[model samples]
Target: MILLLFLVSCNNGSGSEKIKAAVICTSPEAAKIGIDVLKKGGNAFDAAVAVGFAMAVAWPSAGNIGGGGFLVGRTAANEAFTIDYREKAPMLGFKDMFLDEKGEPVEDMSTYGYAASGVPGSVDGMWRFHQKYGSLPWKDLVQPAIDLAENGFEMTRDLASSLNYQAENLSKTPEAAAIFTKTGGFVIGDRLIQKNLANTLRKVAEQGRDGFYTGEVAEEIARSVEEKGGFIRLKDLEQYEAKFRDPIRFNYRGYEIISMPPPSSGGTALYAILKSFERYNPADYPYASAEYIQLFTEICRQVYADRSEFLGDPDFYEVPMQKLLSDEYISMITDQIKFADQHLTSEQVKPAKDLIAESTETTHWSIVDEKGNMVSNTTTLNGGYGAKVVAGSTGFLLNNEMDDFSIKPGVANMYGLLGNIANAIEPGKRMLSSMTPTLILKDGKPFMTVGSPGGSRIITIVAQAIIRVIDYNYSMNEAVNLARIHHQWLPDEIQFERGAMSFSVAEQLKSWGYELNRYSSYGDCHGILFKNDGNLQLGISTRSNGAAEWY
Candidate 1:
């Protein structure tokens, strides 16, 4: 049986009726900041803005001012939209930037150091969203982040572990090393101050987008990149713009799913997977049963195969969105699943033109305000502490998002996914991404807001959560906490989270000729579900030091 997890309650000013404002973020401090914004009479958009800036301070592994991501939001009046803050390759970037004399990828060129950094869009993205939707003063939303950076916050065990894990890379850059490392190295419970970052945030609060993208901050970024042998110029920073696009909307079991569109492949892949399952009732197979797992794995494999061949930055490439999402296309693919079959060979599943394509290290937050406003955001630096390089005096890590592009066609990037021309590097192009920040609605009102950070696994994790909720009748907590499995159509293996399935189920899968891999955990999801009765429920992943706060 599923149990709904009710977070603390918040009352409207009159204290009569409960105001269902809630926030679930990757860190307690960030969540608290968001909730505080709600308490100050700000709406969900304001809370999201506050959380985005605060996460940059508290969760540096993926939450970063120097990085970029997407935001999916619904206004109190039922307006749905998306902001694409995804980072773009610098104008100097090229298809062969990562190649060597022999045309082989240069060692770590796409994943580390200055060359990996893209023109950051996080600041501009936030600014755009706030400009259109925020009710709070821009400076007010950023002040908490500035305060946290200046006075410092106690480093959590996870942050300490991440700092240590990336120590070697961090040590390579003086700016990064100075902020993360103490004489004795990073330690849990130690106060970590980012005075320089605090000053940078102050400028952003005072001057808005121009504060970060131009002037002193922009010059510092260029200097850091040039000093370390990179091509990003002040022009790249100045040209950066966060786009506002229509959110991809699809119907699943009568509920409307709103998600980020390309340059994020997440929404398309997710829609494909869910639509593939349209023919079957998940409850009939029993949750996590061998039968269900086998079917789920096959669908994942098919959807990802399509993702590699069909998805990319729409600005640069023509994505066959209508054809891919067509009922005919979904039926054609779903027909391939044979219930009695143990495995579907790659050869048996015909590839579209025989082409292939695309972090667990990212952050997500979900918020729903009292008046029915909703926001689902996923942000990243591409890798832990991103390129492990900080822009000189900026005191923030730079994103290695260039690595997200297919540096070598048909070859896997750092995330172990292959790609083709659709995602290849190009000047001024946004790299293809798998960040899926999604919102779901029932009867045209917000039902649930969900998103996670797990690189390619994000699409599957989110799809499975929705399946658990709508099909299996799991509550928000149960849906999020349920064990999960992922199959990305490559390597022909199914990776399952530890304890997600039973030993008997694994043995059964093997008997059916399937290869299985196990991991301790997968994605860290944060979610909010608005109940029919006007109450709210929240769930934060136990895998991370996240929190769910309401009121």
Candidate 2:
């Protein structure tokens, strides 16, 4: 299960009824499946697995068995764990795999074709999670997804629109075109079913991880990729394993922050970004004021500068975690912004320390049971309907995560995020990612579980949400509903949601030499906040076509 928990909430001074458990995700059907698992006496871990699989059937845009992501959680017993199920380059993969004979990168080769895929680890990741901490039968946990795929479900407008928008790319694969764009295009409320996906889910339910990594499923995945000029081989599939690592733990004020580690720049970048504000409390500045935006943007510039220069897969490069998160490093970052009254251009900030190194088509869910167990997971296929191609007869979309690797040093990925040799493609190497699955603990107890889907903006989006609750004492809902902003160092521009800043504030920012880019919105954030009074407050982003269900 992909679990990244962010826990922090205020009671809003109301006597809300206590909740025994909660499930929040991008799909109502998936959320219901998770609640049912809790109702069936399953723990948060079990609910997480159920929800993760159900998303594959209910929300195919980002959720998947053909992709991989990170999971971070804390058990009722106070044990913390993180599973790195990130996809890896196939064994046949090479540094220049996406480059042409002219020594230039072929954009299409790594963004929308078979060569874009990586060896998926979601199946093995969920199985590892279940085996480690789940309290229910593995088969039972996955049955809900199987049922949904087999019996079909009502198509929502968002899903239908997404399918229609991607018709051209998806049409390249006969299987995808047949399943997603049938009858010219699906309308809202149309019944959509996937017999092939249902069959694949059955194999997983019956045989656990082996069902997909071996046997017919594996053969077909490899054959399809190789036949289309991709590099995946049977050996790559058979050797794929999800590794468990210690959660990245840090104390932000009084609350304990837990998040994913290397291969995912989220945790490290988040820590750097958050710690940079230790001396300056954002609460002191009015929301979206010129002062607040300047402070926030400057800090983001410095941290993201570090992210581009020094963050990458730990197994492939030595991430300077100690130095990056060190008190000295954070102090250096904060000191720069503390004295600066104007916007700091990207060119003005560079990774202070010399080092190495990482999509927006991702999904996140949060689950918290009454027992004090909490799970926050972020999973993705690297883009909407990833690679725009389904594995032949498998009924799953493949991830274009390989593009996440820097096709060439200093080159920007699809998300407009830059990287270097530290994140270059290599045989069996995991690509760097920005998926942040986080958990917050207050006084050693579960406080909240939160996560989101926003590609490169994920780290900053998550950080902003946590700040709203922790510093401003906003309710979970308020924190999520509030407009958000992002600033990656390379672009040297600030991206704000349409309503994130007032017109005057936008003009002020521009006057201060900050380029502002506004968009409708991004990120489908879902979180469960455990209140001091023992009530659970669920928060779902208004921008999401999802729900928050609890019992």
Candidate 3:
């Protein structure tokens, strides 16, 4: 098979400066796999499917088939769309599923073990994209992943470190333990292979979505959940389907910004942030200056407050989209950012009617083909080695995305973002997500595709990237590599990547009475910018083991 031949071939790229097609992913192997698909006469969609599956094998910490996500793409014909493959609550799930008899969240029920797993949508999602835009055979798109899983790949130091970090939890699940831990424990350079997962991928390749959502695979998932005292059933898997939705879009400084809509709070939050920022000219504030950072932080807090009060799955709840995105509303929020020396108290930035709105451990990749087709995809298992439970015999990690729901009305989820009833769990409902796979258009043509993986911070990182490129005229690399900060409203603290602000700037923010927290890194953003000259510029995060290659 062509896939096998490519698999055995040396992992080398032409590295031509004049290359047109390109792919940037959080895993080097996944990026190469995507480029291979592009090289084999596939379009951006085909390359996306290949990269999606390949990441599942090479970067299981966040990449996954047992989880779900969103895909935003612009076809060569200029049609833009978003596919919401986000995981759905199982049929047996309920608003209080995670709550104990005492009306408190049960310990670990919504974040760990079998009970946390939602009905996964990734396979169905990928298959749907292939049905619409793929040129390569479905099996061909999946073969590289099967080969990688069966034949094994060298464990990177990052993967080894991740394994060790999750070793205690992974040890609880025998299937996960066997695959992630060696006899002497996991180590860098070890040849990590998963025979069961390879077989699982083989079935998926041969049978398509049914290969995993029904028959043996489905039965195993149900049995595992039941055996572990959870509630998922085979019917949930049998009924799973990925939905196509209109991509949420807004004009930001004349650039059309496209992103996934609700069940993702990302689009609305992003739109709100960008629109609010439009009131202030970036040229007026030096980038990352204390004044600039303070203004950005204040606006972020307001936007996130709105998110907690209004964002939810439109299918299940009535999201006030028109009101939320109104020019008046944006201006109202923008007006809240006052003098740089002053900060808005949490009380001043109130949520609407006290109503509800809405991982750092996800994977995102950007792909652009020579034909003007582009894809921005963000997939996740909802935390590193999600749920710490492997479905029996499947060798895939199930997402703890149930934690994404409002287990308690005012309580925060794993990401520390609070939610209201609008985001509470319901049978067969998709939980709200922050996965913002975005594609920016210039004059109705693809200009940039970007996204990141950072729990609630995904929206902020993506928004910053857009501002860096469109407003500040930074190259794709500068946009992605620029230091970032996040303020999710409830925390009331500014979390900035170390060096994102200089010591003077940090101290200045502190002096202004803003709580500041620093981290070595925050999110991993991968992006591809299409230069007007018809060349592709790629940017992969420095905090990750990803790669950028074009040909």
Candidate 4:
């Protein structure tokens, strides 16, 4: 294990000028795995594959080897590819799963019970992306995770903290509790380790994914969930396949933004927000002032308003992709953002719902290689502990992402984001998501590598961070550490991160007629930009335990 860690830590890049390379991920273990890939002469895709699996073991709740997610990458040749491995509903799904006897939303059923899990796609997605663009073979890619799991990777402070925060929820399931608990639940600095999940990773490495999809592991998942009154079946497991799709690319002012399209409203909405911001400059007013915040929150409100009413699985819904991305609609939205002092009430939203607190179940990583390839990915299991159901002997969590759909209009989610008809529940469909993994380019060269893991706030933080770096002249790290502010539309209250916003700007926004609430933190963003000298400038947000390594 020590030898493997040493191998992962060593960086021996060669060739013309020793091309700069870096990878940003949630765990040091995962970053080390990425380094291993680079050591093996693997490109960014191969490194991403190695890090993806390693993160599954180190940051299980968000890493999601058994769940699903989205990935966008550009190859050394500058050709881009997108993989949509997001979880899908079982074919047995009923539209009324979220409705109660009185037709009111049964939120608890979707958030915590047996019916919450979706058919997983995480492994399939990683496998497919790696197979197509990676230098390492699939089995070789699985080897690192196998070693980490089999020998038991040490728990870090961040992992320990996250585990403790989820003790109550994780302890509910015997399988999860047995692994995460020792004595009185996981202590903040406890070393939580897993032999079963490691063994499972080992089996996949040697026997292939078939060892999971059609064998004993699948039985354990089905039996466990079935015992809990769930609907997961062998067919769901065997039929899982990751999808390859074209990414949405659009011009935002002078730069080009590439990101996941629909089924994910995050990138679309972010693109729209930036386009609108381009129409006006923060230079015109004091940055973070009340006036600036007023306009900022209002743009967020308008974009989320449309999301609640019209966003959904593109395959099942029209989504008006063209209409939403059109300059006309964006102009219309920007023109309506008023900074005058005022709180937007439910009455103000054409359609509305009583909102609630945000939910989390994801992690993100961004990387860039000297060869000019870039990767940004977001993976999740829908919430902490993920349906509180582990895949029995496999020790994998099932995603509750299915609850992201709107069973009824005017419904509030864990994120306080409103749900409506456009995002209605369906079988074999995906739920709306705010995992915005993005790449911004300038003059056909990589300028920024960025993304976030926050649920609904993912879009806001990424947008704000990019603006901070490119427009406000903040360094990559400063941009990420700067204070953040968010407004999720239906709630109609602006939530600001603990510090950094100018008091005068906030006061100006409040006086301009906005309702403000202060939060200890918002979504954290990580990014890297190319300096004119050709050196790499990367920043990881302090709000998260994320880190960036360059060589």
Q: Which ten residues in a row have the lowest lDDT in candidate 1?
A: 1-10
Write candidate 3's Cα lDDT for 1-551 as tens digits: 11111211111212345658888887777778899889889999999999999999998888899999999999999999999999999999998988888999888888899999999999999999899889999999999999999999988888888888888889887888888766556778888888889889999999999999998998999999999987789999999999999999999999999999999988888898899888888878889899888878888888888888777778999998887878877777777677655768766777855323317899898899999999999999888888988899998888899999888888898889888888999999999989999999999888899999989999999999999988888877778877899888878889888778999988888888888988668677888887776666666677755576567
lDDT by residue (1-551, candidate 4, tens digit) is: 11111112122211223328888876777877786677667888888888888888888877866778888888767787788888877777877777889999775788785688888887778777876887877778778877777677666666677777877887787887888756554545455567788877776676666777768887887787788877778888888777887888888767888888888887788877888888887688556766667667777887888888777888888877777777877777776665575445435855222221124457888888778889998888878767876877787777787778876777677777787766777778878888888888888888888888777888888888888876777777777668888877867778887774677666766676667788766455677777666766666767756755556
lDDT score, candidate 4, position 269:
84
lDDT of 1 by residue, 382-407 (tens): 88788988899999999999999989
List candidate 3 stretches off by more than 4 Å: 1-16, 354-358
Please provide TM-scores, in order, for all candidate models, with all chains considered together. Answer: 0.95, 0.96, 0.95, 0.92
What is the Cα-based lDDT of residue 61 in candidate 1?
A: 86
lDDT of 2 by residue, 1-551 (tens): 11112322322225444566888898889988998899889999999999999999999999899999999989889999999999999988888888889989886888888899999999999999999999999999989999999999998888888888888888887988888886677789998799999999999999999999999899999889889888888899999999998778899988899999989999998898888766686667777787887888888888888887777888888888888778888888877774324545688788785432225668998888888898999999998988989888999999999998878887788998888778888899999899999999999998878888999999988999898899888888777778999988878888898888889888887777778888778888877787767787777777856576676
lDDT score for residue 53 of model 4: 82
lDDT of each: 0.86, 0.85, 0.86, 0.75
- What TM-score does structure 1 among the candidates reach? 0.95
